[model samples]
Target chain A: MQVHIPLKKVVDNSYDITIDTLPKMNFDTKVAVVTNQTVSKLHLDYLLSKISAKELHVITLQDGEEYKNQVSIDAILESLFENRFNRKSMLIAFGGGVIGDMTGYAASIFQRGIDFIQIPTTLLSQVDASVGGKTGMNNKYGKNLVGAFHQPKAVYIDPYFLTTLPQREFSAGVAEIVKMAVTFNKEFFTFLESADLNNPKVLQEVIKQAVQTKASVVAEDEKEKGIRAALNYGHTFGHVIENETQYKKFLHGEAVAIGMVMANEMAVKMNLMSEKEALRVKSLLEKYNLPVSYVIEDVRKFYETFFLDKKSSDSAITFVLPLGIGDFVITDKIDNGTIMCVLNKFGKN
Target chain B: MQVHIPLKKVVDNSYDITIDTLPKMNFDTKVAVVTNQTVSKLHLDYLLSKISAKELHVITLQDGEEYKNQVSIDAILESLFENRFNRKSMLIAFGGGVIGDMTGYAASIFQRGIDFIQIPTTLLSQVDASVGGKTGMNNKYGKNLVGAFHQPKAVYIDPYFLTTLPQREFSAGVAEIVKMAVTFNKEFFTFLESADLNNPKVLQEVIKQAVQTKASVVAEDEKEKGIRAALNYGHTFGHVIENETQYKKFLHGEAVAIGMVMANEMAVKMNLMSEKEALRVKSLLEKYNLPVSYVIEDVRKFYETFFLDKKSSDSAITFVLPLGIGDFVITDKIDNGTIMCVLNKFGKN
Candidate 1:
């Protein structure tokens, strides 16, 4: 018999984000603000001034992709338990993608699951991680290998925090925005090509467009059961790059920037994308000062990394290739020779 | 914008359980059969003979409630990782409720979440745990205080395993069956009054009724958002009892047996159920030799334990009381004076 597991709309606990204003959500339950030392020192006061929680605690972990492991996640869970946070408690993910991912995961599993709100302070997180319900901590085996598809109660995206963001971090966020446009929104891609991303008004419009595009796609396929996989246009290659570097060498968005370029090259080789469109994508990425090149040492070694990705099946690597700018195809049927040629181009170039 | 996460229906997976025969679905992926030493000694051979997985590994845990902790759960996960089990690999929960709950939890968090199937060998699990998506490991705080609502890929029940179950364990399963009937099915309750529970034919009918009843309730309220909390008819009191005793003195189902009696007494005090109906419920439990009595040390201490229960919020302790023979009510409105009277009565006894 077909059964429907009712989707719970978590009301009474919600928040909204205006572009330049800090989010203000008053929570009566025990609230823990999870952030990295970098974000905490930079904008913790700005966030605290806006929050109206009854009793708020700040938990700061070491910053960076290397700190996204289970040890860091365990530390976060232990702190919450030590504070006697109950199921009614809430966690505020107050950093970049790494902090948001780990906090969302810790919330998802702590006391089974608890209420959590995302106060994404990173541009990358603001554009990508905030909308997806994917929450998990990284392990030695892989990134987000130990996690749950737990959605946040709400997301508070205040671009006001971005004023203090490092320039490199700013570029990283745009890399993700560029990815959203490549596979799903060609018109948005063109807008990004000419817009001054540093301008607050243009950034606000970009954030809204990216969120709406992601929200519509997520509503259609939340679990990546079908159409949602296309949203992973740059992620398949990005994950391989992240894994090869042990998630240490580049910012997550920066790695994805390189991944998107590599994907475009593969699409052109497969005749799925015209060379002109592929070059147009690289130029757009470069316009935002995002990396459009990477040095791949061994093509086979790079190809082997794809299988380790959670999205890959046992023997086949799923690729999300752009047919051009707005349209795309998901397939594992690409021949080995074509893949090798694409990898050769990125190999130590 | 409100984004709804579309729940994935695992179509490639799923199986039906029958009373007389074992399931026939075969697996080419690696399989870990998680069972207790007791169940393994008795039924492992039979289960192993039926599975045609590429490689089948047996990881036996010590058989007891005390063994259901993070240490045991981690052992299972470590073994899976050691065996190089990938995302496609599956874990089969092959014992009673404790084994099933821990196994399901390990699978849920391992590599984010992997697939798990339930082959409930105990009656209590077949009727209750196997149907719900709840998976957890207990700690000093409380029973099931840490867990997730991760449903199994499939559940398989073969009553033949029950043939070797001891009378104590067998009666424990009956306690859950009785709980199910009393809370939801009046006709089923009437059937139980005179039904020969030990008879194989009668037991099969009872198991099917309990499973189907619980399944319907879970389908409607997967996350225990509303109607599903009613399923915890005797659990609120039962959990406190189990906690106070350190989960050592009584089997989960056994504590629940005494808890049901306590709930009935409260119901009679509130005039929700007649004394005669309560007596019938007691007599049914007595026929199976399930323990329906406990000594209370202090009335206030016992009452305080209710508040610590995960279900209880700051407002009041939620009690699931019987409305009549087969109907029940889940509420926190039962006054302190009434609860005190019940606890005081326990001390007197």
Candidate 2:
């Protein structure tokens, strides 16, 4: 007997990413705001004041990228179970990308997924993580090695949260914003070169531009099958960098800033980007105080680290490089000679 | 700025459930056959004789329900990362329901979702677990408390595997078959009552009928929002029984068999089912040597266990009782007095 499971339905996981203000949230079902101690202490009252639920709970986790692991995921789930939360109950992610990722992962696995809303408080998360449905936690193998593509029901990005962000963290976020401009919009990149983001109005516009650029890319490929891989513009190099540095030396966007620089050198070798064009991207990154350089302790070891990344399938490492700003090319054709030559440039003295 | 994710696409996760003969499987990508010590010893050679892959790996977990936890899930994931299996890699679940659930879960979380196929050897998995996309592992809270709904790429069912199955396990599988007939198909119930499934041909047909019943139910409701939940008919009671016994005394199907009888008793009290009808269902279960009774130690404590089930949302315990042989009534309306009375009847005197 041949039984065909006829599953044909239109799935609409689409949600709005609202910037500037956090609206009053009212839920008939139980809601848990999964946050970190750092974010909760700073903004928990502000977040709690806006929500009214049949039963509301605050689950505070230890703050740090290191805390993003299975243990924390288990804690969030344990809390939900303890509170007798069900599939109808919701989770609110109320921190940086770490909280958003962990909350979304917990929501995804708790009773086979429930609704989760993102209230990303960090600059990097607001512009980059907010738009993508990628939710995950880090394991010993690599970052986001274990995760799911569980989308948020909605996203609330308030510029007000950025007021409390540290300067280095602020620059780390600008790196991601620059990534969006360098990959998709030339005019946006040009504007960013001189944009006074200190002016809150300009910052809001920059966030909008970055988010809109990401929103469109994610809209095309939600699962990162095709065009979505382009969004990993500097992430291939960045992930390896993070892994080498044990995710402590740099914030995600800061590593990506340097990763973008490393990728540009390769692009320059390929003649897709000239030295001047690469220098322009570096200048824009420097303007935001983002680190644009790193010394690879061992070029061979650094090159080998690329294979450990989840993006590298089989023996080939797919590199997303600049086709001269505002456009890009994803290729696996770069030989070891080219890779080693480019990597050796960043080698130790 | 407000950005819509724009995710409106028809997702077709539908796949064929081929019964009787296993097809010659081939994969262009890396393939890992996730099975157990028992199944692999009995049938791994037979399964390996049918497939070819770019790179093949066999991951064996401890062969019991107790092994179904985060540790096992992590083990499966760790093997995958160590093997350098990327997004293009596929997992083949080659044991019973436990292996299927864990493998599917590992695939769901590994690098945020990958493809998997189900080769269900047990009658229970072939008829029930293989059809629905409910993939998860049990936790301290209850069965399948942490999981996701990841539909398999395809499912292959071969009746040959059952020849080596233990009689108790075979009877347990038959319990699920009876569950399918009781909830939705009176004709199938009549067929099951008189049919001698000892004849391989008849058994294949019965499995077909049960799989078909489940296929249609799952097709209409994948996420268990409305009609799909009705399939949890006996499971609501069964889960509590399984929890009470710590999943040690009886197999899942045996517990569900007893649970159905408990539900029938409740239905008889509610006037939804006659005493004769309830007996008929019990007799059918007895024909397969399925357990149809349990001794509750504490009526109130036993009743409290119902809340621990993942199905019970908030404080209300939803009960699914038979409304005659081919129909059911899903309601949270049954009073605690009625529940206690029914539970006390099964209590130790």
Candidate 3:
């Protein structure tokens, strides 16, 4: 006989992204602000002043993507256990994408799961990572090979934190904004073509638009089972570039900047996009000082790396190619000959 | 400006529990049967004959509760990674509770999450652990101190597996069945009071009744935020006993059996259960050859261990005390003097 265990419960995982100054937040239960030494040195005092809890603790780790691993996650969990933090305790991600991803991952597994809020400091994370529920760490195998779709309770995106961001990092953030515009918003792309991000007002407007586009896509598909895969337009190739480079040569968004150009080349070859459209995207990345070119060392080896990607299935590589400036398509139908033709364009001479 | 991310989606995580001989089961994706040495020695070939998948792999760990830690979980994950098991892969928990919990926890975190089915071999896991979504490993802190509420895709409880189960282990399983009946169903409790589980028909009926009662409670509260904590009638005290003995002295269900008797004494002391009612419950446990008494070496030390329990928050300890047979009251209001008075009975002279 079959006994049905009905688990029908309305899960309200919805949260708001506030694009303004940091608000004074209070928690009745214990809270931990998980940050890197770099971010904490710059804004820990200010963050502590604005956030209060019955018992608040700060856990500081070394800065850089190199630190985003199981060891870092264990430190966070160890701190929670040492403090006797219960299930009701909350965590605050107080750094960039690496910190946000690790903090969210640690919260997702600590005592099953706990609530977390994202206070993204870097420009790249504020516009992209903070809004998405994807939380994970890089392993020996690949980046984000281990993770969970754990949404934060709220996201406080204060652009003021960008004042201390370096010029190169600021440009990296702009790459993601360009990606969002290229995939879904033509008007935003048009605005970005001429808009100067050095202007705080224009940057704020751009960040808001990017977040809105991502929010809509995520709202439609939270788990990346459908339209959500569209958001990873540049990530498929970008992941491989980062993997090949040992994640040391380029920043995440900068690598994605180059990845988008390669995808656009494939799109142009397939008649899905015009050469002019591809150049326009390349020009946008150039405007932000983002890398727009990479010479392929070995075409076959590069293609093989795609299988290691979480998006790839058993054999076929799923590529997100641009249909036009504001449209895209997800397909595994792109033949190797066409892909090689595109890769040969960037092959080392 | 506030950007709203509406993540409103209906999640249907319902699954069926089949209570009969293990049927022919098949999967199209890669499958791994996670079991222990003992269970594999007894029934691996039998299980392999009945189950088929596109790619079937067996992951065997050393048997016993002591091995249920991060190491075992990592071993399972390492095997998956080595075999290149993707998110679409499935896992079969083919042992008892430890295998089920660890398999479920591994599935919950591998590539964010994957699907797993429970094929419980022991009575304790079949009637109790198989149904609930709770999955995790014991840490240095406590038992099940770390876990997730990941429901199985399905549960296959084959009574035929019990034929090979040791007598002591069989009694341990009955302890869980007794715990279920004592706290939820009076009619079922009456049936179990005199039922000979050695009789196949009577045992099947009892298992079905126990599963049905659990299903109703789980339906109302998938997470233990409210009424679901009632199911932990014996676990709160049992966890401490297992912890105090370092999980070496008693089996999980055996500790729970003694825990139920302790709870009954507390209920009688509070005037919630009559002495006769408490004795009736004890008699039922004894009838199954389950241990119903445990001597506390240090009353205060045992009392202090409750704070480490996941169910307790800060200063208050939530006890699921019987209001009478087949009824309970979850209370934190019981004063320390009364608690000590009850502990004094179990205290070594």
Candidate 4:
């Protein structure tokens, strides 16, 4: 009556996030370095110098969160197809989260999948996006509405590239660092509050810490089934904000910064965290000049957008709220009145 | 120097293929039954009557391999977003390989993958597509060029639906069955030579054998890195045929049928298979009235198209040829002359 399609094989998909200087690597197969014009303009030659492949090509895409869509994915895919890049071929995602996400996504779906490496240039990506296997592109529906969990072959997190990063983009990266600390490690949160990231050593340590927190979480729950949802401490509200603002008004990390503040307000109202602890987190975000507030024109419209987020189920919205600091609770039990109250506090644009 | 993204976790993606009368299934989550117009007209009511869900939706796509493209994928994704389907939701691929593939693909990308069930109505899907986790759609380049190996949660192979399957479609399924027999099982090949498939019991047994053979191979390789390539015995040439004709000339299995003949020619030329063995295989194909020969207007063009296949590396095309009735050898060593000679045998379209 039944035949079993047994997939009982164990796969060691474990890879390391090596925080070192960029190494000159030689590859035996065709390789494409998928980057954006912005990153390529500053670092393309430097990146190109270090990588040698049997056949090497560069694919430059438009930069920014808005460009993270199906069109960009098609561009990366089209290049691979045109070159007759097969499963043995590889892609090197060589930019910020936008380029990394789209490139990783294109790698995931191309010929069912091929090896890809991450040479994350932005501070945000070097810490968060580069390590996790979450590859996706944003669609009109929302951020990461379409993606796959295809791990990269390796990730190189070199701090040297961050030297050319814009201050605003650098601050955007700090927001993600702050996120990791608040949800997973109180010591790291305290360290981040006082740490001067302008110092290269401090920045490297911070990148290592944030990546470690994300790595452990991803290792435990790769699919965000349980403990991994904790990583979305600020993402629930952040995704809706990104949608309402059309993904142009704020960087992804900036949106999450505001989402964390919003979640803190809800946490305070629900007695999950003291107002004092909430202020501490908010002040830390302000330290980096990460956007901590976004006024919603219509509170109801902002609240309704949460339903479109992949994190929400049909019946209720799943919110990840901090349990003071260094821990969190993933709950869908928050009442509508409580959420509306929190959203209203952001005021109007 | 390093932070580990330790994904040393084992995932058991095993599922059973049930071959019986269609069974009533109930789900607690929102469900979408993705099928085509033809299947809907013949079997929608019965399928709907047997399926109950908290929120049920039917997405009927155009029936054909040509419709298996990004446009169709977008349609499926749009429906999920419009209906507010989430990770907790499930999809039931309730038609043939086309429906199963697009549905599985849609599910794989929806919120970075979700659970999908396969209820394959066509024999080609029941014994092949429904069991393997391989999910994708065709593009202008080739068949299944873009896809993910996202396994289904389960498969229901209800033979009752096959009674209404057109004679040609039935033979298309036979092509795949004959494929499994020739590549892996000498006894199975002998069974097909004399087996009365019109007998329901005989057909069910054959389906079970094919499923079993496929199940073991998938269990060993999972991602087609080794023995699984043997399953593509006819697919390399078949994909080019489908691409050349724009997926309109033959059913997928039918193309594979002709592809098998082409591979047999190469095998006989290389002394891997006896001419007598090749003739016996061709005769079995004729018994089912499966298409065995295809004329290429330009053999050079057809030969060049093999490079476009996913199985080919940049340098050489991999071919799976039968060493005899039940054994296979995967090689990329055949020179240009031998392949052209075989294509010359097929002649112009």
Candidate 5:
């Protein structure tokens, strides 16, 4: 017998994102803001001045993608438990995607689940990670292989934190903006190609567009069972690169920028996408100073790493290949020979 | 500003539950059938004969309610990690309520989460533990103060396993049956009051009714947000008794048997239940040879322990009092003086 259970009852986990500034959110529960040292140094006082919680605790970890692991998740959870946080307690993920994912994961498992709010300090997180309920710590196995789809009660995105962000990181965030544009919105891609991101107005619009595209997709397939996987456009290749480089060579967005180029090569080889459109994407990425090139030492070795990705299953290796500039196809039927040809071109280039 | 995202998803965890006799369920994943030495000695080979897994493992723990603690949960998880059981694995709980709760808790947190199947050998588990997804290990803080609402993929209730169950344990299961009947089903209570439990037909009907009732309730409220809390009819006082005894003296259901009497006493004093009806309930419990009395050493100390229960919140203790023979009311408004009066009566009696 099957019962149709409706998902309603107004789950009251809501947070606001201000592209221009951060807002003070008051709470009675014990509060822990998990952040990185860089973000802490820049905005901790600004954040502290704005909020009135019962007790405010800050846990700052080293800033980098390498630190987004189980140890980090453990540290955050241990701190919460040590502080005697109850069910009503909240965690504020107050940094970039690394801090956001690790903090979100800690919230998911600490006492089997609790409320957390995202105070994304980076543009990449504001546009990408903050809106998605994906929470996890990376393991040696693969990126996001160990994660729970835990939605934050609210996400507060303040572009005020963006003032102190380095240019490279800003470029990285633009890479994600480009990813959102390429995967779902052709008009947005065209708009971005012509827009000057240096202007605050255009950057805010960019964040809004990226979040809207993500929010719409997340609403349709929150758990990545279908069209949501399209969001992993540059990620399949990016994850392999990150693993190969030990997550130190490039920023996550930069690696994804290169990955988009690699996937475009595959699309070009398969005649699924025009070379002209691929070049257009590359040119746009280069305009943002996003890395559009990476050297793959071994084609076969690189190929083997894709299977390890949690996204790839036993029967086939799923590829999210761009169709033209804004549309994409998730196909696993592409033969290895075609894939090898695309990999070889990257080597020769 | 806000986006509605569906964070919960039906995980790709589907398993068949064959209820006839017992089928051999062995797989390639590292298997750990967490059973006690007593059950292991009697039914270990019977279980092994059925389970033909790639790496069949057995970690028999000591038998008894006292053994269900954080130490056991850690040992189970440690064993799984030591055996290198990855995220895609299974843990079979092969004993009573203690084994079921501990195994389920271990699976819920092992590497953040894993799959667990319930093979309830005790009547209490088959009727109570298996239906609700409540899984946890007892800590020094209190019973189930540390737990998660982790549903098992499936439950296999093979009555053949219950044949080896001790008479005391058997009566303990009856206590849960009475609690279920009184709280939710008036007709079930009426049937139970006259039902010949020794007869196979009667026992099967009672088990089916209790399981179906519990399953339907869980399906509606997966996370104890509403009607699910009603299931804890006799658990409030029972938890205090178990804690006082260090979970050693009485079987879990036996403790509940005495707890039901205490709750009925409070109900009679509060005018929620008639004294004559309360006596009828006590007589039914006595018919099963279940304990229906306990000495309250210190009313103040016993009252303090109620606050430690996960269900109780600040300044109020929610009590599930039997309104009559087959009805219960969940309330926190039963004043302190009235509660103290009931405790005093128990001491004097």
Candidate 6:
């Protein structure tokens, strides 16, 4: 007789994202604030003053996209174990997307999972990475090749942190906001085209809008088994660009900005989007000083790299193309010749 | 304004445990059979003949409890990455509890969790570890100090693997069987007292009863937040013993066997269980040639070690005491003096 084990579990990973100044928080359990050196140097003192816990520890790692790997994860775990942190201990992810992702991944596997709170310091993370529960680390093969879908207990997005962000980084973040608008909300895209993110009130409102759009999509599909894949509006090409440059040449959002331009070109060629509409999207990105172009050295090599992407299967590369400003389609039907033709336009002879 | 992200998800981690000959299995995706050198040398061909996958690979690590660690976990992942095993790939844990646990953990964190099947070779794993979704590796702090609650997609328990198992290993597995009976099923405990596991039919029946008992407990508490901790009837003390010995002196099941005896003594002293009932339990373990005693070098040192145990908190050590043959209680109320008194009985002095 076959003995069936039914493991029925209902997990309510619901949490609030508060957009304002950093709030004074109280945690009875031990709390570890995981941040990078750059963020810690600027704001660790302020954060420490605002938070109180039974036991508080600060774990700081080097700041960069290159450090987002297993070594950094091990450092976090080693700190937790060295401090005798139990399953009840909580982790606070501070700094940018790299810190948030690594902290979330560490919390996911530390003693079989624990509670974590996201305090994304960078503009890109606040609007995108911090909202989603996707926690992982990069590997030699690709970005986030190893990870878990572990949602944080809560996400605290303080737009105040944006004041300290660099201009290029701020523009990089705008790329993600543009991504959200292009895929799901035309009105938001229209608003973004004219909106001045330099204005604090407007930026806060924009962050809220992007988060709400993402939250709805995530609520409908926690795992990317369905509609959630649309969130990768320009991510397919963006990942390839990041990999090709060894993640050093472009900020993640910068690569995505260029990726969105390439995708819009493909959409225009397929008659899914108009040339005028594509130009409008490019102009908006240009307003933020985000990169709207990349010169591909080898079109064929770039095409082959898509297969190595986590989103791609053994047979075909799945692409998310904009049908219009607010509508998109996920398809693996893009032929190799068409993809190469688009890449050739960006190719340097 | 506060934006609430409702991440409501219902996960049905249900699977079947088949107790019969190894059935012919087919998988379309890449399959990695993670086993040890010993198990592979003995039954790799037999297993390969019964399983077919699009791309099959075998990852062999060193045999023994010493190899259940981060190094082994890394090796498994490196192999998967080298083979370009994607998220859709499946892992088959093809050994005892150590192999089952590490394999399950590798699957859980490899690409943020994937599917895995358990083919437990030893009796201990077939009865206990195979049923629970508890997958982890031991660290310097303690056993199973780090892990994830990753359930297997299915479990195939074939007693035929036991034919080549060493007699010592066989007795060690019996300790876990005795553990299941004493905590949850009195009638089952009585049956185990006289059961001849050498008889294939009798062993299969015992395995079924144990798996069912474990299934019920796990179904109620997947994360061991409540009554499930009762299953750690022998593990609390066992982990300390394993750590003290550097996991060289005793097998996990053997350590647990001696731990059960120590717990029974504490139960009797607390009047939770009668001396006669405790003797009967010891006799049953002895029938399987399992160790019933361990000489403690220092009572105070042994008591302190419990604080380092994952189940214990900063102040209290949670103990699972048998109320009688078929009942148990989980409490941290047991004072240090009472614990020391029990340990003194087995003290070398």
lDDT of 1 at B281: 88
Q: Please list, in the order the candidates appear, how each scores on TM-score for chain B only.
A: 0.94, 0.99, 0.98, 0.99, 0.94, 0.98
TM-score of each: 0.89, 0.99, 0.98, 0.99, 0.82, 0.98
lDDT of 5 by residue, A1-349 (tens): 2222222244433334455566668998778988899998988998889889988899989998888876787677667655666566789999999899888877775655778988898889999998878887676766765556678887777777788899999889888889888889999999988999778877787888888888888877765779988988888899999998998889999999999998888888888799899998999999988988888888888888887676765446788998888899999898989878877877735
> What digit string (tens of lDDT, one per residue) describes model 1 on residues B1-349?
3333343333222234444567665898989999999999999988988898988899999999898987898789778766767677899999999999999998988766888988999989978888778999887667777789788877777888889989898899989989988889899988988888678888888888888888778766777878888888878879988988988898889899999999999999999999998998899999989888888877678887776567877558888899997788888898889998887788845
Clashes of 4: 2
Q: What value of lDDT does candidate 1 attain over all alpha carbons?
A: 0.82
Better of 3 and 6 by lDDT: 6
> How good is chain A of candidate 1, measured by TM-score?
0.93
Clashing pairs in 1: A112-B147, A145-B111, A145-B112, A146-B112, A147-B112
Give the lowest summed-lDDT range of ten residues in model 5 chain A: A1-10
Q: Candidate 4: misplaced stretches above 4 Å?
A: none
Task: Select the stronger candidate by DockQ from 1 and 2.
Answer: 2
Model 6 docking category: medium
Docking class of 5: incorrect
On DockQ, the leading prediction is 2
Scored by Cα lDDT, where does model 4 land? 0.92
Model 2 misplacement above 4 A: none
- What residue pairs clash in candidate 3, if any at all? none
Residues forming the 10-long window of minimal summed lDDT in candidate 6 chain A: A307-316
